[model samples]
Target: MTTDDPATDRTDREDFPDWLRQLERDIRPGPAVRLRIWCRRRSRRLMGAVGVLLVLALVAGAAAYGSGHLRRPGPAAHPAAGPAATASPTAAPGPFAGTPAAGWPAGAAGIVLPAAHRTGDFSTAQVSAGLAQVRAALLTARLDRAFMAGRSPDPLLRHFAPAARASVRKEYATETIATYATRLAPDARLAPDPPRVSGRITYQATRDNDGARKLAVTTNFVWVYGFRDPGARSGYSVVLLHDTVVWHLPYPDDVAAASRGLWLHRTSSYGWGLDCGTIHQGLVRPGGLDPAAAPFPEDPEALYDPDHPIAVPTHC
Candidate 1:
């Protein structure tokens, strides 16, 4: 049962215990058993690969959805119920919404005065006072409801120097009042809301041809009026008036009391959306509202822009 020689000491099948030998023989796999084992390993690896592919597909789908490349089906649209269900394709915008005056301040508020500062030889206080007087004049000429309604123009003329007031009044009576103030036509009625105003006022000290020192104040403004037009496209018609008024303030002691106040120096104005046929009457009549009104050429963009030089009014 034992050997002492080194070569003979090697283990043999006989050295295995009975139980171990029996177990080895009983557990030996045949062809079918080997095949089953191979199939199980292959199936596990295939399942793992399939799971990886499924995860990849889910990630790709999520990315596509985030990028807006994937669109999901939505519920079908239902038909509208009423005969007027369809909306107007080219309907006009709401009152003033489509025009440049949409954001402008209403009434006299839009005549913005520049901060008073010493310019040339004028003092800060004098500049401030001059600006105030100019503001009052603008409000009376453009925004005064009574004046626009065809009242006496004395209120506006009162602001002018006594010597200049007579000439201005003479012009007011003989020439079209349209140049000096907005006067509505006998048949025209403005909307209850105040007219919209926009523009700026500036002042500087300058000399006349005779070298007399004077503070020159200039105002550039656009006044937009909405007249009641129930039959018009937007339920109202628009009239745009642009005016530039210049006033000269002489030193207190330079002249007599009667000529001491602000003097109307020069003025230029242009208006759009007025009936050319009746405008010569010195009253405002909205053009588009009347079928018989004559149509004149105008650049609407230029009308709304304050910096654009006034275009000569076209007469039909």
Candidate 2:
């Protein structure tokens, strides 16, 4: 439908792009929330695109809570006083709430990033599902090894909308396995392997969004990189057992889909985010943590230590 179509205007579709662009510039992590954390640095333009899409998803979700097929509920007579009188009570979902999608990440408890209060106007499930889509998109960004090898980040990037796809593709076009390997070892190189990941993500659904539930999702991941440990002190040391940080990545065997599988974003947008509570044993030293041995140029803070920071989820 053209911008002239009334139906298009109803969903704010015509205005969504403008609204989205503004939100991207303004969105920030709430209390104890992490923002702009990516493990490996990536193209800012690509990440900006990803951020826009993520927030847009949340913006759309705010409406998902309407009780009747996007229908707003009628007002109640003589509403109760105080919190009890509010349209959304903690105990009761509001007229417009949503449900979580199937197989989305859950159970990573007490990790909610504190921020503006939500009026129970939405279904916790639906908000989570919306967040899951973002996570799926992130997972695709992290796990789809094809992108790093100068291949299409499909199936992985598929989670993203069409517009997002265009942005990611451009970034991939500029990358190559040799570029990363060269960065890791200028003289003595380290072989690259798929990075493994695990962690909890939390959300803060905000009061903004003009009756929609614009929200932000925070990710805390533990990544373990595997490589052909070239037992050389000059390069990455075999300190953790084989010149690499010996840690187990979090791809669960039961997870059947590549989209949901645990992995880190190669670019420094999503995969690198960490908070105090997420450190874990076998996790590489933060000072030394970077993508594709990209940290090689910098001095490592510490080698892989089993006793190093092991992330513990913060929100109870």
Best by lDDT: 1
lDDT computed for candidate 2: 0.34
Runs in model 2 deviating more than 4 A are 1-120, 146-150, 174-198, 207-212, 229-316
lDDT of 2 by residue, 1-316 (tens): 2357778546543333455547757873332321223212345767798999999988787767654554765665785566644465455321112211112222122123232333244355545455556554444443334432333446544654443445544444342211111112212222332343334455554433233333444454433333333342322221111111111112223233432322222322111222112222112211223343333332222212222343322211
Candidate 1, poorest ten consecutive residues by summed lDDT: 8-17
Query: Model 1 TM-score?
Result: 0.65
CA lDDT of each candidate? 0.76, 0.34
Candidate maximizing TM-score: 1
- Candidate 1 local Cα displacement, residue 160, angstroms: 1.4
**Residue pairs in candidate 1 whose N, alpha carbon or C atoms collide under 3 angstroms:** none
Q: Give the per-residue lDDT digits (tens) of candidate 1, residues 235-262.
A: 8878888888888987665667787777
